[model samples]
Target: MTLYARYSELLDTVLDTLQADGTLPDGIERRAVAVEPPRDPAHGDLATNAAMVLAKQARTNPRALAEAIAPGLEALPDVSSVEIAGPGFINLRLTDDAWRGELATILREGDSYGRSDAGGNERVNIEYVSANPTGPLHLGHCRGAVVGDALARVLEAAGFRVTKEYYVNDAGGQVDTLARSVHLRYREALGADIGEIPEGMYPGDYLVPIGTSLAAEFGDEYAEAPESEWLELFRTRAVAAMLDFIRHDLATLGIHHDVFASEAALQAEGAVDAGLERLRSKGLIYEGVLEAPKGQTPEDWEPVELTLFKSTEFGDDQDRPMKKSDGSWTYFGSDAAYHLRKAESADHLVNIWGADHAGTVKRVQSAVKALTDGRVDLDVKLVQMVRLFRAGEPVKMSKRGGTFVTLADMVEEVGKDVVRFIMLTRRADAPLDFDFAKVVEASKDNPVFYVQYAHARVRSLVRKAADAGVSLDAPADLSLLDAEELALVKLAAQYPRTVESAAMAHEPHRIAFYLYDLAAAFHALWNRGNDDPGRRFLVDDNPELSRARLELALGIGQIIRSGLDLMGVEAAEEMR
Candidate 1:
């Protein structure tokens, strides 16, 4: 059993014994009893407020309960001391052997040391990068993609059955515009000038390659065909190429979606019609004129009666139109069906959207409630904008043609590891300033380098041990590890708990910060060795102690690797 598990069990015995002795009531809730490291590390190793929490319920003073509980805990197997602090805060000091116990557990479990079943085997579908297929994904999509992918991996690590999905917006007028753009590109491919890309045509040079490929296939035939005969054909090929490009872009970041759900396909079998009919049966679908939108209502505001859904019933600000006056399905209509399809497949749906889509949150949430009859929850995580920098100046990237930065460009410039890590350095809702020059720096200010250096030091120690002819077989003579090394081990062991909490909160940046702390702990211990010779990891003459220290180093190295793996960062073995 883990040291934490044993500690929890011993604490339980104390609580139960206290209840039996009438120091506290028997029917108190035990869920809030959390044993975690104290905010001020000097106070103790671990702290809990069990007595304080139960005081109100038991109608007794917390200090009295903690005093009664302390003796029961002090008698346990690994107990060093149990002290009742201010207002019944129980601070427990474990035997040095308990610290040794943490190191031993790390050596035994390695990468899986911090793994937990905290997710309760629930299924979650994380949908992200639902960007339009109009063009290649710009820099903005990159942040959401990394955040969502990392969160999905974290949830999986925490034992949730996670499905990483991408919703394709293939049915909209945007695709039609893309088709027309490709048609223009088709004409240009057949040796036409195309004349300044026209007013509305997509002007990206990337489409030149698609047009060239299409020309090679059709050989001037599509250029001569009418819009009706060639629109669908070019649209299909163009979207496929766009999707292929997007897929390759995601692959560069080590992200792969388990499902690529098509919004158009949801309407192939009249599913949208059937879904709206269902809403109609439930009295949600109605014909009404929407109140003019605030601030920007047109002067020609004719109250045209259109079919609407009473989204306000499910907490939306106003009723929404599912179909426009032309009887074409609106964007929200397809989204509602898509969410319904998602509800049919997964236990829950989570969407990662950009800040611009923030206002759409309530309507989509309301639609999901109406579609599922409040059976499924649609949680939308709004990721704010990301600004880029290079050489300490802003790197301006416009969304227009020839001005934008592709996800590939950023990844190519600084590499995927640096790109992914920097993107996750801030919370999704917060703005991130990513400076390429600052990220690759080798100093302590660069968190990426600092964290990787911690791992490399461990690797160096492991190499030194092998060179010194020490056997790594014995489960790490952890008793030789001092206070600093023990603290590092304990911090590393909290990774699984950190990931569980981060995933539960829809926050991937937490893992980024956790790595920083873990790295800081390792750095602190490394710096300690400089001031104290006995604390150094290598002792050439004392081979036994050297082996145990090597084991601790290897344990730290393993944690660095595991943590880096989760964040999709590279764990550098040696920083040259």
Candidate 2:
């Protein structure tokens, strides 16, 4: 168990004892009491607000309660001293043996050091990077992909059964556009002189290969077919080809979704109709005309009575239309059915979308609530834009020319690990600037490089110890570790708490930040050894101390490796 968990258990024991002795009231809720590290390490190694929180309920003075609990806390095996501070805060200083035992646990658990059962095996579905099947993925989709994939890994490490998912928007008009573009390429491949692509058509060269495949398969068979006879056939072929291209691009970043729910399939199976019927029974579905949007009404806007969902009843700003004027289901209707299908089996649903979709968040959440009768929880995380830069200059974009930088282009420029790490350097809702020159630099400014370098430095130390005939596998006398050395171990011991908090908050960026802090702590300790030879890991006259310091270094490395694994990053044994 982690030192923090041990301390928490001890605090619980103290509270139980106090209650049994009739000094505190019975049935006091202990869930809000937290035992954690002090914000200022100068105070103590650990601090708790148990007395402050429970005193009010127990009808006693907080300081008196803290004073009453101090003796019992100081008597605990691991605690060296306990002090009552301002108000009712209790500060604890643990023994050297406590730090040593944590290091031993790290060496024993290895890569599983931070694994926890905080999630309790609940099933979670994470949907992200559901980019349209029209072309290769672009810079906009990259952040959500990395964030979702890393969150899945983190949740799984916290013992949650996670399913990575993607929603294929093949029923949209974009696939038809893709089919027409492929047909243009098909005609060009057959010796027809098709000039520059007409306006409103996809002009990307990625479609050339799909066209070539079509030409080879049926040599002009589709050349003379009517639009009705060939539209569905071409749409099917184009969507499949685009999905293949997308899968390959995702593979480059080490992302593979466990499920690909198709919007077209949901529509064809009448799931949308069934879902609407269910909402209709709840009086959430009705035919109504919506008022013009307040801020920017369309120039040709006209009132039309259409099928609408009572989204306002469930916290949306207004009732949302479910059908278009042409009697076809709107995109919102399709999405509602898709979420209903998702809520059927998963205990929790999470969708990672771009920030531009912020306006749609409320309506979809409302739809899911109506569909599930509030039985399921849905969380939508909006990832902000990512701007690309090279040498501090913004990368250009040309929407008319279809010349945005694709995900494939970025992956080819930097390695997959670098791309994944840099994409998560900021929170999902914050805009990130991915500078080509800065991310690849081997300096403290680059987080991934700094963290990896720390792990490699520890590995280098182990190699040096082994070269001098030191046995790292043997147990060490951990009491030889002084304040600076023990401080490093304390930072390493926070891994379990970090993992649990990050998983519960659905924030994978926390893991990245924690790893960087750990690396900084390790680097600081290594620098300290430069002026003080006695503090160094290699001591000529004291091999026992040297072996113990090596164990501390190895334990630090184990934690770094475990944290990196959660982020799906590879820990380097040596820097290039």
lDDT of each: 0.83, 0.91
lDDT of 1 by residue, 1-576 (tens): 445556777789888877788777778898888777777877777788888877788887989877777888789877788788898998987778877777777777887866677777888999999889878776799999999999897888887889899999999888988988888877788899888876666888888888888888889887877789988888888888999999999999998999998888887868788778888999999999998768988888878889898999988889999999999998888887788878886777899999999988998999888888787788899998888888889987655556888899988988899888888888899998888899999988888888889988988887777777887776556777777777777677677667777878878789889988888877877776687877778875787887877887787788778878888887998988
Candidate 1, position 137, lDDT = 79
The alpha-carbon deviation from the true structure for residue 333 of candidate 2, after best TM-score superposition, in angstroms, is: 0.8
Candidate that scores best on lDDT? 2
Of candidate 1, the 10-residue stretch with the lowest lDDT total is 1-10
Candidate 1 lDDT for residue 20: 85
